[model samples]
Target: MLLPRCHRIKQPASRSLFQSRPAGRLFIFMKRIGLTGGIGCGKSTLVDYLIGQGMCVVDTDQLAREALSPGQPAYDTVMESLKGACRLEDGTLDRSALGHLVFNDDKKRRWLEGLLHPVIRQAWESRLHTWDREGCPMAVVVIPLLFETQAQDLFDHVICMACSEKEQLHRLLQRGWSQEHIQQRLKAQWSLKEKMDASDGVIWAEGPLSSTFQQWDQIYHRIVSP
Candidate 1:
């Protein structure tokens, strides 16, 4: 991808007195961009391209995994809520087992979300603030449930990656996922049409990778420009 250099970065805006405090305490304003897409829409690939274009990117999926690691607060809360229903003999939580418990059942899914979302939100906010303090020009947040979670308001702009249902299914199958698993994961997310309607911009990912990279380049230019 060949992205235009950021005009904003070349011309730093003047800061208010509040932003011109002591070096260690000074604050910097950075754009918060939300990147979302449906399952199998190649969102990770898009984020990678954006990162290559010099945008600081945060992976919510990776953070979610971190939030549930053995010693994490949310992990302890989840274990207490599940009460050994999702635990292994070795005392660690069985994530695959827990996934089966919630993915197929809406009530259980909501219950788990209730337990985890708050912690995830807290962590996300802290990271955002830290990045802002460090003077990052802008950042991209890779959120898979941006629409479903009603988190669009959290970002200055939202980008949705999209593909045809057939293409999505084919991509999932290529990853060796079963048909049932694909359907279940799809059921867990809003449809592509819904996400596109709610997004500030859309990147179509059904074509070749080269074409997708070209779209990414265009988006990078738009994002970094005023």
Candidate 2:
């Protein structure tokens, strides 16, 4: 059975950019929800469901990819930072090479984050402002490192998706990730337990598609309704 609506939940304290004033009083406001989870935890699947339900979803990963593309703001800096190690002959980024480099080295990973994070933040904020101006009722921003980047403050509520660690590893392996790469990526983020404890809601993504969708439907109604 689905969980009941959480009527006792408190309103967010900080005002978001989407809040609107009407007749001298605040009225409608867009609820900015952050959906996050570790890599290979099926966040994209949940995001698709939300998009299908008519919620505006701003995927940070998409923004990052754009930012890293040639002629984008982060592209030159990233290539320079990597010292051409991950630059392809066609003047594009070699993602696999870059991934292998940074995931294994703490300093390089931090350096890369430093370069890309500001650009990603700017893009995210810009999109939110656009959606707010368009009067979107709610938006879900997918930030894979929401907690890691200390960006939880940007959302009205957070939903963390989780699965068993064994399942997590298995899923990544199915994606052709090496065991070492999987471990490195996992170690880079906050544990699932930590994310779950900090979030307003949790979605266990260990079961069948129908079950996951059911949970998502319940959570979606709760968030989109009063």
Candidate 3:
């Protein structure tokens, strides 16, 4: 149910709630849509489909990885705060080791979030500004922690991609993750129920890919049409 892109271009929607900079003429034509989901809910796959549809898509997970890579400011701060124990032999942050450390310990988890969230948010905003000027069809940001970080207000619309817990566990198993790893990651965020309650829309990923795309198509039309 997508309105033609030209219709969106001719009659833009109101400015996005997540937009920080001025909604220049270009951005006036673009809408910012956020897609969030838990560890095994298939958000990445949906984002890829959106990108294929000619939308600008940014994966905050990828940005977080970049922000924490060796020599990045975030990398430096994390290593300094934890006193070098979070590093691997190659001097890069041992993400798996760090994950184990924080996932089980509330105190360490808070400290890690305190250090990383601000940096990642800033990076995300920068990318958002850059893309807004490019006059893309629309923009999609994949933020796994959208609700956990209280960033739901940062987008024009927030979509939660969800699945049954049984399906979630099954998906995680397919990824070769241990049951303990799955539960540990899931425990770190707001539960699926909470995420849906907070989002403007919900795309249940338990069905076929075509069904998921159909939901996405409807979302794009709702947001982008003048």
Pairs in clash, predicted candidate 2 = none
The estimated TM-scores of all candidates read 0.82, 0.89, 0.83
Give lDDT tens digits, candidate 1, residues 99-136.
77798888989888887777777778788888877788
Rank ordering of all candidates by TM-score, starting from the highest: 2, 3, 1
Q: lDDT at 218 for candidate 1?
A: 74
Model 3, TM vs. native: 0.83
User: Candidate 2 on 1-226: residue-level lDDT in tens?
Assistant: 2222232223565655444454455546878888887787789998888788887888999888888899876888887766878888999888888888999999989998998888898888888888876778778889989999999988888887788888888899998999999889889989887877778777778789777778777776777664
With a 3 Å backbone cut-off (N, CA, C), the pairs that clash in candidate 1 are none
lDDT of 3 by residue, 1-226 (tens): 1111111112233554344335433224457677897778889899788778777788988888888998898898889888998788888888888888888788989887888889888987888878766655567889999988888677777888888888888898998878887888888889887877777777878678998898778767776553
Output the better candidate (1/2) by lDDT: 2
Worst 10 residues of 1 by lDDT: 1-10
User: How badly does each model clash, as a count of residue pairs?
Assistant: 0, 0, 1
Question: What residue runs in model 1 are displaced by over 4 Å at the alpha carbon?
Answer: 1-28, 88-92
Task: For candidate 2, give the lDDT of residue 135.
Answer: 73
